[model samples]
Target: MKIKLVAEHIYNQEFSIERALNWILNSMTSEFCMRFFHEWLEIAESGTQQLTTPSWKEIIELKEKSFSKFNFRFETNSKDKQF
Candidate 1:
């Protein structure tokens, strides 16, 4: 629910995704935070439209930082198993 709105804002360039990430990190304080990132990625890759290169790069960098900072392990049901 909240994640969907944030992802929509990201796609629309209404605010910095990094700012949203920071807010989630500071406020969520639970495994639930991962859902926000996952939902963003899912929406970005859903093929309704292509992300601009800069937006894509930003997402990748933020993902790496979040995973490393929190020691997150990504699991996907998709056979390709890619993030």
Candidate 2:
């Protein structure tokens, strides 16, 4: 499931990274997300000139953090399990 978390910085006009972090952490538990991260890692590690132009660190870290925070389980008999 996708979730959106905006900052509630109505008082001092400050944003909360924690809120975003929490939302991201929640999204990381999916198998699809995990696969995406794996692909992202591959691209990041390629060391090609084109891939180095944009910073992939933030994207990788955020998604990786989400995946790291939760554990996924599959009930498989043949090979892959159904959700």
Candidate 3:
């Protein structure tokens, strides 16, 4: 995603970051958004570089941690189990 943005000369374009971030925030579920906000706050308070130029591994780790509280059911055996 970052590569595509950079390749298209969209990285530093005016309001690009805000637009992209808004899109991402809008795409997320409320639960996921809350989790992401808490994690981001922790990183901000900790003065961590993980929020900037994160490596793929760091990104994956962050994602996993953010989702750790949720229990996902992939099977559609019941009507209520539908995503």
Ranking by TM-score: 3, 2, 1
Residue 48 of model 3 has an lDDT of: 66
The Cα local distance difference test for each model comes to 0.52, 0.46, 0.51
Q: After superposition on all CA atoms, what RMSD does each candidate show versus the true structure? A: 19.1, 16.1, 16.0
Q: After superposition, which runs of candidate 2 have C-alpha atoms over 4 Å from their true positions? A: 1-29, 48-51, 54-83
Error of 1 at 59 (Å): 36
User: Per-residue error at 52 for model 3, in Å?
Assistant: 7.9
lDDT per residue (tens digit) for residues 21-82 in model 1: 66556655554457556756665675457644336766666555445234323233335322
Clashing pairs in 3: none
Off by over 4 Å in 1: 9-13, 30-83
Model 1 worst lDDT window (10 residues): 68-77
Give the per-residue lDDT digits (tens) of candidate 2, residues 1-83: 21212223211333244444554455554655776667666666774745564356756564655444444332223332211
Ordered list by lDDT, greatest first: 1, 3, 2
Candidate 1 vs candidate 2: the lDDT winner is 1
- Candidate 3 global TM-score: 0.36
